[model samples]
Target: MNFFGTIFSYIRETYVDRLSYFPSNIKISLMIILFCAIAIVELYIYIIFRRVIKANQNKQTKYWKERIGNMLASVVVYDESENTAEIAVHFYDKLKKLPLKNSTVNQILTSEIITYHKNFTGKIPEVLALLYAKLKLDKRSKKKIDSKHWETKIEGIREANEMGISEMAEEIIKYTDDENGLLRMEAQAAYLKLSNKDPFHFLDRAQERILDWHQLVLFEIITKNKKLTIPSFSKWLRSPNDTVVMFCLKLIDHFMQFDAAEEVQRLLKHHNTRIVKKSIEIIGKLELEELEKHMFEIYFDHTDEIKLEILNSLGKISSGKYADFLSSRIHSNDSKIKRAALYAIKRDADHGEARLLEIYHHTSPENQALITHVLDNRIKQ
Candidate 1:
């Protein structure tokens, strides 16, 4: 106490005594500045301390992950009988011995298990699923699914799907039409994986537009899973949502559902020209020659874009029956329609080349050039 009193007396004599000579306002300002400087220094030190603590935590997490990963690897490679229960117990025991809080350890363990599950197949995935349940890690994911936060909900949906938690299907399906696009996409994917009965039942009730990327993901999931039953997409051709109807059209073309020809013919007269165009394309690809006459009837009533699609569809059909309709469009003011018409005429297997030559001399220079291009086998379309 005497040492501190001597230091305080010296500091007061050296600094505080000198400040008394200055004006009172200046003195108060100096004191305020001094306190602020001290505060800034203390805050800097606090930040450094926090960074040090975070670094140590990261190191500990990495060490625990490596240890957990090795244990999981051992469980995956056990070539003995399919005794997942015994294996799960042993795995859980090893994880419990780790020197970390249960929540932290479980987080790292869950992540590592999912990584392994994504890479493996057959019995290994089954064993990993068993381990995930035995440790009660699924509860964490389920809770996240119930989170008000959308990002957390997406993570939970992904985890449940990867872990094969089929019982979560009912809860997950509700998010399939979520206002959030990403969450809706993840939920849709999870439903496809988890549900066995009426896997595509969501389509019947989906109100939001299923974007192109979403469709791609769903298509990949469906095609890769051999056991997944392909639904009759023609059922949704009359859907109120135009995008849904378009997606169904793509699926119909892909699966070659010939029975959908009647339904597809109906869409050609639908109000949305985009859907009508898609319907025309599908009709051509499926070689629905019966619908060719209906396409001819609507060809004059639509825009050039739709007109171009009809011409292209006629080329695909190449039934030679639409030669008169193809030739009538050869004089169209739009160059695209003219070229499409010429190409369709050239595609006809019967008398198409001869028909092109017959109209060559009488047509305009631009039409002649297009015809020449179509006729020349060396020119790639």
Candidate 2:
């Protein structure tokens, strides 16, 4: 108190007393500058204090990670035996004896166990799952899932999915169509990972448009998990949602679900050009020779984009029946359509190159150059 009093008295005598002689404006300016300086000083102290606290937290987290990692390592490597339940119980007893009651400690423990679970398989994962339930980390995850914040819900869903908390599948499935796109994506992924019965049940009921990137993420998840039963995407082909139909087409193409070929053939006449174009492309890739006539029927009435896809598909089909149809389009006004036609003609193995040579001299110089480019072995379109 005496030190503070001395400092206050010195400031009063040194500046405040001198400021009284200055004009009112000058006094106000000086006061403003003094307050600004004090604020800057306080801000600097606050920043330094926060840094110290963060550094302390990082140090503590590192220590706990190492300790928990070592303990989990013992559980995984030293206890690989037939009696996994007994081993899990022993590990749970060991963990309870530690300082895991603290939330911070529990978080670290959860993270470390999840990391282990991801890196191992077989009985190891089963043991970790048991230990997770024993430690009540699932309850923590459940609380986060039920939180009002979307970010917290995502974190909870991710933790539960990663930890293989199968019981949380029902809770996570509720968010599959969340208004928040990211939360919906996470919940859908969790449902895929956790749900054993009808894992893709969300697709049949999804009302919202699944974004393109979200589709890619879901596709990757489905393809990578071999255990996941690949459903016949054809069932969704008749969906009212165009995006769902588009995604189902892609899946059918990838999985080579020839069973869906009939449904795909029916879509060639659909009003949506995007869907029609994809249907044509898939039919070509699948080499459904029967649909070639349908593609030819729809070729002239559609836009240049659809024409280009049809031409490309014909090239992939490489059936000699469309050689004349492909050759006729070589004179199309649209340069893209013309090139697509030339490529298709060259790709048609039955007398396609001969057809190109036959038209080379009769066509315009630009058409001749396109034909030459298509025929050139060095350029791989």
Candidate 3:
């Protein structure tokens, strides 16, 4: 019995010692199973916690937005001169009682106030601006400008500009060089909005490419002034950055800055196709009749698109030998070139009808159809 008991003890110690005698592969598999079970439970708990937090935040936002909306409506909807004093006192007392520590609520209130300003302009915007000052929202927005995240900083810049916080202009200008394109664009626009004395100071030094959409936004803002100190875009025509030069050319043409005509003629010889195209557009629009010879000289050295544009520009300058020049292209195989040449002939040349008839008699059926279409369109017009 003692021997049997000793053997039983040895067996228990060697094989039944809580999985110690298991194969290595089985031991590792068991560990992995145990780890997966724990991880699944933890992930399940985390998901529940997130859902609870989101729901609580939604409730808090709803409560705060309601309280702030009523206060804002009173200030925006009330008459500026008469009811403002009573509303101001009521608003301040209520605002002081409300908890301003909730950043979500602050953002909600800021958006509501900005919405009021966006929709209405006169005395209401002024009232909202005063209310914004009284609530000290500007401090909150200004704080976001220094945030580590680029999007947060851009939002702060936007809110600052929307509220007419003129002091933020210099701070906003610092972001114009941000590597992110959207951030740079928003910062530049905000700079223009906040800086009244020098609204265009950013454009003057901006070496970045001003895209077409960016130009449209800037143009709309600059033209809104009842009495604007319009700067001479000629200053930027010589900028080494081609995009800046292109933007200045567009501004000059849109604003009809005729003084830049001499500077514009110089860009016709520029190597960039886009710049040359825009220069041609400006010349055509402004009727710069003196550059006809230069236009003809550059015609053969450019693409078909540029050639078509040259014909269009030549059509605008009727005083020179552009008619005889266009006559040479009337037989080109490229249909667009031939069409443009015909259009230029009719518009620029005095004996263009005789030229069209002569071409029709000797040309192919396709060419005859093109000339006949041009003549018919002229009579219809």
Candidate 4:
């Protein structure tokens, strides 16, 4: 019996030992509860600590930003940008170096200065800002870049000068030796736009490179005062060069006397199609009486080219008397010349519409259709 009690006591102690240390079911439950409680406390503490750290960092950054902004007020004008102002001030104080470079930094600084002036709330400051921009654009420390570059920069300076931009014309003239015609032309146009003046008088020798459009505008300005400068007119009008002659023809047809018109008319007989077309254009611009004489003189001598030119001039002249002359062309064996005459007749054929209607009904279906189409298109417009 003592031996049985001893065995039972040994079994009970082993069971208790297992529960306390090695883990029975009850011990496993207790361990799991205790581990979950500790994990919950640790996670809560981590969250609180992270929030505290973020708040402290933000506070420190804000404090530093404000402090530097207050300090920068001594040297530069303070505007909005509260945070950036603080940071910029701190960067300036910590570094002995400036925020901008000597060459390009002035540009940055100039824009900043303009902003500062604008923030001050007055036109005076705005004007000063403009002057600042002009000053920085013009102050060339070295001439490493070509004249074109300098001229372009100088153009900005002159532009800021407004009515005074003409002074920059002298600077632009310095670049005339430039091989680049485009740059030279830009300078010429810029000079014209700025000064409300003409450089063409001075550019007489350089007119070969002057484009037609630019020359026309500049010509208008130079002649704006009605100062009667005939020598320039003669050089432009009688020049053997086609472009110059075309420009002259355009100007003279619009503004010159009949004498100039007569000159272009004489050149129509010249072999060049250019001169012929130009004269046809001039005839459109002339009075009907003036046109009748010229068209009559050229009428009988009809090369296919001259025939077309006369037809074009007659359409512009539009006299009923010539409707008969044109009617004869309808009978011509040349189909194109007949069609051309039909167009002229259809245009001036007020009393002759009966003749056209008669011709339409009697003529071939193709001729009838062609004439009918031309009449429809012309009359509808």
Model 4 lDDT tens row, 308-335: 6677667666776677677677667777
Top candidate (lDDT): 2
- The predicted structure with the larger lDDT, 1 or 3, is 1
RMSD of each: 3.5, 4.7, 6.1, 18.3
Better model by lDDT: candidate 2 vs candidate 4:
2
The ten-residue window of minimal lDDT in model 1 covers 95-104
Error of 1 at 63 (Å): 2.9
* Candidate with better TM-score, 1 vs 4: 1
Model 1 residue pairs with clashes:
none
Where does candidate 2 clash, by residue pair? none
Of the candidates numbered 1 and 4, which has the greater lDDT value? 1
The TM-score-based order of candidates, best leading, equals 1, 3, 2, 4
Which ranges of candidate 1 are over 4 A from the true structure?
1-24, 27-31, 34-38, 41-45, 80-86, 96-101, 361-369
TM-score of structure candidate 3:
0.82
Model 1: lDDT to the true structure: 0.86
lDDT of each: 0.86, 0.88, 0.81, 0.55
- What would you estimate as the lDDT of candidate 2? 0.88
